[model samples]
Target chain A: MLKSNPGLALCILIAIGAICFALFSGDPYYVQVVIWVFANAALAVTLRFVLLIGELNIATAAFFGIGAYTTAVASTILGWPFFISLLAAPVIAGVISSLFGWITLRTKGPYFLLISFAFTEIVRLIYTKTEALGGNSGMIGMFPPMELDAYFPAIAISILAAILFGLYAAERSNLGRVFKAIKNNEDIPRSVGLNVIGLKILCLVIASTAVGLVGGVHAYTNSVIAPADFTYFVAVLALAYVKIGGEGHIVGPIIGATILTLAGQFLHSFGPYENIFYGAIIIGALLLVPGGIVGLGVRFKAGTLMGRAGR
Target chain B: MELQVQLLMNTLQIGSVYVLFALGLTLIFGVMKIVNFAHGTFFTAAALVVTSVMMWSVDTIGMPIWFSYLIAFVMALLVVCVIGFVVYFFGFKYVLKDLNGSFILSIGLLLLLNGTYLILYGGVPRSIPAVIPGNITILGASLTIQRLVLMIVAAIITLGLYILVHRTKLGLSLRAVAEDQEAAMLQGIPYRRVALYGFLIGATLAACAGALMATVTPVTTVIGDDFLVKAFIIIIIGGLGSVLGAILGGLLIALIESFGGYYFDPSTATLAMFVLVVILLIVRPQGILGHAEK
Candidate 1:
């Protein structure tokens, strides 16, 4: 079934390995890493969804926060079931980002970036200060639908797998082409009589919703949610995933996030020095592999990469 | 009434350092077309330099206060300029034409610089003693003499920068480069020299602000985070590439932050600024002094 695409095959094998590891692997640490990889993979793809339309969104944490918080509130405050809250999280996030997109997407580039930056801080402060949202105490005692230790991670990967498949389908569709057109030249899309704003909002909404769903998965996996979890640094780190993975390809973000997440595992003991390593990874990717790891793969295929065997 | 006067002084005291940063940030953007995320780190790093210099001079070398300050200021300027040039060479040169690449590169630079700073300085907030230890009371409001001196120094630098950008031959070349890189390059202006000088001068101004700030505020590795965000808002509201807009934007932010913080909570102050920037985006995307549409 996966013979036609090697990339799809790799994803399948990885998903299988993840499930097997979660089910049978003795080490909880590696299982957690697998789950973290999946969570970031979903985020990286969501970010790529927006980037596909040429928008430099630094607001991943904001929408993610919205998703996580909404789920927490729905589950705890409103006494909704985990399943319903999980579904509602992305919807709430999508609606919120729609409002944001309506206002801020009017501006482009750095202005868009700044507005997104502001949104994260604003959301964080509101959550931090608002008593209704538990203020600084945040929401705790989240029970996943399943009680098993591995259940949340399994569900998280399943959610991510679904998103990956959905994104894969979208990448081949006409809608993706419109996003690319907008990315390449907004004026061209406008000249073709496409509603540029509408298309952008579409991409933003889709990306926001997907990211929100991941945020829901995140809250359940950790069994607690806090405003601190979705800070600007986390958002920037998400952006770095897509950047270090590669641009202009679907698999780049997955590769980037997986590599970086695993690297984080090793660098965990580095403590304060971990950030320096992250910075070094990003800089190295930009300088040496502007195409990211996938780009390097593409180059090797094209026989342009030094000391690498070409197909 | 006393509160108002103190707030006014407070506005200028913070606004002066903010203006120094915003002006340098805008000038660098004008020349390089890349927003330096590490710009605030530059400010903090330079402040650290100034703080260390003063401590060494006053305690270790036992120099007179004025002489120590003089040495600190000059050395900080030289050191920061070199740092700026090195960043330009290593961090920025390859990605000069690629806006996104350069922006990400600078983001990496921010993390790298801030991390190095944290490890080196150990997260302890430090402050140099006031350049002059006297408080002047005006209208029943007491204000530190250091802040007053800082305002004057800020004025001198602003005036000097205004002269440098508007009057001198080098200024002409720099502005020409900003106007049109290719045309200026074709017109016999050395691109690297103009860019390097503009960047160095901007970095030096930040160094001056950092040094001056050492006398007023505690210096920490993470202190730059707030200023960097403020600089972005200032330049955006002031419009990118306009020094006057940076000045205006700086004052507007300082006022907003001060008045808003007083009237509301810290979150409200920041929240208000965020709202204003959003509204400005809809109404006047070019900013008050920026050219139409970035």
Candidate 2:
């Protein structure tokens, strides 16, 4: 069925899953877990947008933090409406992404990775060191600025769906094709008079904006924010979602986020040992199935599952 | 003038330890082209190893502090050497041919190592007793003997590394493999062994650094993250894949951070170093001494 009409099948499957999740959203724990998954999915998908362009950004969490803090400060400090504050999240993220992207995206590989990685540190440091930002204690007592609670899962689902669909739309658009072309060979387009840097910055804006929006939602959902929440671990974990879910398609983040988020719950009882479990799974996944669970499914579909699991 | 001397001493002490850590990283990266994200974990693990060994010997066996430190130092090296060997075999061997693959796998190694450390040690903080206590006042500035020794140790190691890389068979094999892996293989250079040797030596050096730093500061699992980032900035500004580059880079960063912290907020000291790296990359992404990619 997947091969027969992959797009149609995916749409139908998600519709059914979203409906079931929405029905169960009445439970606070269920809704919270679902929100966590959505927030992470948004982040992983945003990360995917750049990963599509063959750039690895480990700073999506920083942008996510930007959105969260912006929302927190706007709502609590300035008495802004949730809608207005939320809008500022992505706008702020886009502006920063463009500025930083222009400067850092000039380099690639480790250079690109390091600069992007530093972004999280800078943001975290600013938030931690600046007393106005609440420093290490962070800000709390947040609620969704609008009647988002009445809609609950509808709002959450819509946000997650919008990011996924936005990504889906991009995959089908000329921009996506250009992204692919750029990713495959930046020089090929450079010879053809394309503005490579502009496109790359565009990629950053879109990805950071999506992640930033989720950050606002994340703050709204949690009602508390801390610098510790947006660390190097979160960024790396988002990359894991993309890698293990399947980077080639939009479904990868969905699958990867769902499994890992659920797995996190399963291991919660283990306390500190939970990280050990997560680490082991990621290491095993990288060594044994670097292509991720989706790739494994694809391999199984074609009957080449044997002798190729260790790639 | 007193403050200036003290700050310079502080810079040298920190910079020396950083050189120890950064050189190991540059060595592995130079030969393998794999960024070991978990490079910091080795430092932490070695500290843990040294701390536990020293505590056990001093508390249980009633050994002297100096003798216990000696035992801890050798044991830490052995433990970290094993960790490096395991890392190379489990992480590097599989992704040897793929740069992107190694990068992703290294993150996994990092998470795995971090999680493992958390499980074993919990979040408790411990400190390694100073192996060489007491201070030597030099020109109206008092500095710990341990720190001054570390500076000299760093200088000696730098000279030793230069000699080893230039004058030894193992270094010849490593240089040959690094220069041209395919060509080296054709010439029957056991590049895999060279990689293993490099990783072990690098790990041993990192252990030395961890042991040294732990004496002066507290040993916490997360301490590695800060040092690792500094090492990264050092290699980035100094240029990756060169020993001399790491030394020079380490000192430059240490000085910037020391001065920056003294003049500004101490918490933003790393921010200063990070900003310097960004500006450096914008002007010269290949780093100060790194060869430009063809």
Candidate 3:
């Protein structure tokens, strides 16, 4: 499969290299940055996964938070074993997202968008209000087992990279086609006896589960989890990454996340100007490069081909 | 009886501003078919302008408090209107009827404008001294005179909007376009122009709410953002693009917030609102008065 798809091969190679670097790199800071890029990529990709059904799912942030919180609770409170605590993130996120999607997928467009946004905020509010979750200050002390400490970065990056590949594989499957069909017009899919709503829920569950796993990894990586980290703004930035990287392909968001996450490191010291910088980039991308970087490349390639044809 | 009356008063006071804010949001949704997340920025701009103008007029220029407030109110409206016009032309116009595009655009504007406000105003919250001092008893419930005026003015503006929407030529155009853009255009309505007017009207309503709110609450760069989540809940409950729905939704949410906050705690009130929204989605996804989504 990798031989047939050079792009897929390149992605795998990059993931392998990233894992190797995490394992061998001397600087913990750089390793931490690598974990963040993959985590963010997971977020942006999962967000775009829902976009397959043509709905903007802001609840991506909520589910990510849920995953983190679940792992946090399982590890810190219940004292669950490492793997069990980590695996609980996806299970809990999937269950909640399925329920969330089942109830909300009935309303599409603006209603769905607004409701998901409200859900994200409400979930964050719940965290801040609940004392066990550590409230506004959030929870800390989420450490991987001491034996696994040296390998945690590699572990985190590998799981996050797996999420990216797992989603890409799903997107290329027949189920992905059904999602696109539903987006084009649900009525047609329904006419064919497809359970449109169930498929949407499935789509959401798949994406949420992936994000939840990332959240679990995030819990271990950051060693601290807070309510503020999971604001709807998280989804907004993911959407920005999707837009700037070009949502036309799965790779777009990954690329966008990498660039922005790196840029963010430098932008950290700029104070209020950081937000202004991101805001400007989003607006500029929307107005100027509606398709993002990937889209621009496609247009450029098409233009060159046409020029050759004309010649 | 007094406690009930007091809660009712609280509901009306909170609901009045909510109505103004949600009306703009729903109106924009109706006319442009885009959610303006930056709607709060308009509110913040107006409130910021109000505080600055009030300080200048009352403190520096030595104007009377009431007179200075009037100046501040009008100036706030003007400033927001200009900001509204600039954004409408530069950004919102291109994204008309595009939901995700508009959402992203508004968010970007939200960040940019909010950042600018932060740099200009700093992080401190500012409150102007009351223009109208003293209190009055209504049904054995004591109320501040200033709050009473806010409710009255908000009511007047809301009523004026109702009349303008239902009784005027422009209102006909707005409703017609919102119902069906193609048909409205076929009937000779200038869709783009009407959308601009609707957007401006919505921004002005938010400005009015912000200006009025500045009188009661401390004004901060982020004051408008506090109202954003609640306003979304209000519109969702009221039904998107329905003026009446926004009004009813605003009041309903305020009632819940006031009574629930009073009976339980603030966080419980918020959670209760979310629970209510979930139940609403289950029972009537379109909202209390919202038209069924096509």
User: Top model by DockQ, which number?
Assistant: 3
TM-score of 1: 0.95
DockQ scores for all predicted structures: 0.64, 0.61, 0.85
Against the reference, the lDDT scores of all candidates come to: 0.83, 0.81, 0.95
Kindly list the per-residue Cα lDDT of model 3 for residues B49-70, writing each as its tens digit: 9999999888898999999999
Candidate 2 TM-score, true structure as reference:
0.95
lDDT (10s digit) by residue, model 1, range A1-311: 57888878887888877877787778878888888998898888887788888777778788888888888888778889878988888999999989899888887776677668767877898899998888887889777765654566676787878887788778679999999989888998899899999889988998899889888888777778888888887777877888888876877888888888988888989866988888877787787678788788888888878874422
Question: lDDT tens string, model 1, B1-294?
Answer: 999888888888889889999899888888887777778877888888888899999999899888898898888788888888888887787776466787788888888888898998888999887678888998988987878999989989998998999999998998898888999999999987788888888888888888888778898987777787788888889988898899889988999888788978678888788888888888987788887763
Local accuracy of candidate 2 as per-residue lDDT tens digits, B60-153:
9989998998889889988888888888887788777465667677777777787788778778888867788898999899998988887887
For model 3 chain B, where is the 10-residue window of minimal lDDT?
B285-294
Native-referenced DockQ of model 3: 0.85
All candidates: interface RMSD: 1.4, 1.7, 0.6
TM-scores of all predicted structures? 0.95, 0.95, 0.98
Q: fnat, candidate 1? A: 0.49
